[model samples]
Target chain A: MTALYQQSLEGLTRLRGIAGAMVVSADDGLVVAESLMEGIPGDAVAALAASLMRRMGTAVSAAGFTPPSFMHLQAARGALLVVPAGPDILLIAIGDRHINLGLARIEMLQAVEQLG
Target chain B: MRALEPWVEQPLMTFLTESEARLTLLMTSAGQVVAQHGFTRAVDIMSAAALGAAILSSTEEMARVLGVRPFRALSHQGESHGIFLSAFETPRGRWIGLVVYGQDTSLGLVRLFFDRMVDELMAGVPAEGGPKQVLAQNFESELHSSLRALFGR
Candidate 1:
């Protein structure tokens, strides 16, 4: 289980513009395992990503749409992509603005299925 | 205070009206609001700005530890509405965008125009002048005030 998490995370970072990746708890925002480069702060990502996920859940459920399968945040600097790796775990990816989002989405979905 | 303000206001208002978003806010990376549309209350703006800034700062730290560059945008999709947040740099300074939209618009639509908005904001809008990259004085103190405003403390 640990190896799977580590391997997938390490693999995510190899993608073009992908800087780091990690698996975190959606409920508690704790880091399970991470493949982070020198400057990326995985701990804070894990915590805040989880918190944001919780908040998004509230807004989503209140509105009556399908519970979000995942979430993405876009900015001028780069992109922060999160998807469910498991029932309670979130896969977080940080990439450059130039990163191919289409491919990143495919990679994340595949990783989730494989993890499942 | 910033010459860039006039240029962005019109475009942002247009985006909000055309896109039918509940709210769209533009702010300094330090969480200062430059312009906003579709908000009924000032407190809501203050809350959104603080949260947006907090999330961006934390995510930037996440990027630093990941040894990657930075994550520019973020989003959360609810049932009836969705939130899209992104950070970008301009000649004026680094800024962040926080958007809230309902079923009247989809995330993809907001995104499509948002990218265009950036292009519009940067290239189309001419900067009259204002000591490029100028930012609010005492950002930390201002952030504290925003938090106080948010909590009514």
Candidate 2:
């Protein structure tokens, strides 16, 4: 599990415009593993990103809408991309505006499936 | 259909209206029906629940540690809009969520909703002891591991 998580992070780094990546447990919203940039606060990002993921899930439920299979939070500084690896697993990516979003998403989807 | 006041109260909701507010589905955190807007009527309810469940569990856990509060996600579906917002309690599991779906829903708007919804839920509920110390410790470690993976350092 740990090795695979590490590989996922490295894969994120190899992507263009991406700042970093992390493997988080959607069940607990805690970072299981990570790969980040210099001086960047990896812990805070993971925590906050997990928090955001939870928030997105709840919002989907309350409005009488179908639950979200995955969440994609995009910001000006960069984008927070989340995908479910399995029942309790998630793959998150933080990237700059220039990142090839469609490509990154495809890569992440493939990576997450591999974890599954 | 109803007065837009309730819907307009949330910026995220409005954003969904402007966006792909044509095809979408709505639901509650507990797998109940609150509303369902536009879609092919062939939407996958299970997928929606999976998405909501993942988010709900995480936020509830975070609220416990941050000493803020808990919230739930509220969804609003439009033709092209897709939004999900969850509000939570500080330490003891009390929150709400509001999600909106549409084409014009910007990430900034979604974030704005997140900030406001947290504030709203926190204010609405009474304070409580944050997550247990032991649980917090484990969560902290988990956070570290995940972040390292995210950064790929």
DockQ of each: 0.03, 0.02
Over the stretch A1-116, how does candidate 1's per-residue lDDT look in tens digits? 98998888887888999998888877546678889888887666676566667678779999998777778888899888889877878898888899889888889888878788
- Cα RMSD of all models vs. native, in order, equals 11.7, 17.0
What CAPRI grade goes to candidate 1? Answer: incorrect
TM-score of chain B of 2: 0.38
Lowest lDDT 10-residue stretch of candidate 1 chain A: A43-52
Off by over 4 Å in 1: A1-116, B1-4, B128-137, B140-153
Best-fitting candidate, scored by DockQ: 1
The residue-by-residue lDDT of candidate 1 on B87-142, one tens digit each, is: 88777677788899886555545665676688778885556543234345556555
Task: Estimate every model's Cα lDDT from 0 to 1.
Answer: 0.74, 0.56
Per-model TM-score versus the true fold: 0.49, 0.43
Q: Give the true-contact fraction for every prediction, in order.
A: 0.00, 0.00
Minimum summed lDDT over a 10-residue window in model 1 chain B is located at: B129-138
Taking chain B only, the TM-score of every model is 0.78, 0.38
